[model samples]
Target: MKDMITHIYKGLECFLLECSAALVRRRALGGWRSDPRQLREQRRDEFRARKVAE
Candidate 1:
């Protein structure tokens, strides 16, 4: 039971880290955007590229 809990916690931590990284990338790209649509597209492209690279 203890080991299962530890594994679950670790998975959650990794998920949170990924979310934070995506948010950071979104914010950074957002700073350069003047249009909401462009920002959304930019984030989507960035996320795709990162996933492909990974």
Candidate 2:
């Protein structure tokens, strides 16, 4: 029926939109931890842990 076809079309359109949005979010956040400040902090933490273990 036409109603069923319309429902299916809407569902596919929503799914495609969600997929594209997720791809955009992935690209945007892919380098989230590459910030120099965060890297430095992580290194500092590791160094402190090593010092504590020794």
Candidate 3:
């Protein structure tokens, strides 16, 4: 019984850690998407690429 509980606890802990990591990654990416400077830089890169392709 003790081993079973320990196994379950370890599984839950791993699951929670994975979820936390995913949330952190999502927030980081979300910040980049919402950042004005990042958006502007992306747009500038796109424009430059288009100009070069022409």
Q: Which residue pairs clash in candidate 3?
A: none
Per-residue lDDT of candidate 1, residues 5-51 (tens digit)? 99899778767866786577667766545566766687677667866
Ranking by TM-score: 2, 3, 1
Candidate 3, which segments miss by more than 4 Å at Cα?
Answer: 31-54
Task: Give Cα distance to truth, residue 51, candidate 2, Å.
Answer: 52
Top-scoring candidate (TM-score): 2
Q: What TM-score would each prediction reach against the true structure?
A: 0.53, 0.56, 0.54
> Over the stretch 4-54, how does candidate 2's per-residue lDDT look in tens digits?
999899778766865565455446656544455755565567556755975
Model 2 / residue 13 / CA error / Å: 0.1
Task: Show how many residue pairs clash in every candidate, following the order shown.
Answer: 0, 0, 0
lDDT of each: 0.72, 0.64, 0.66
Better of 1 and 3 by lDDT: 1
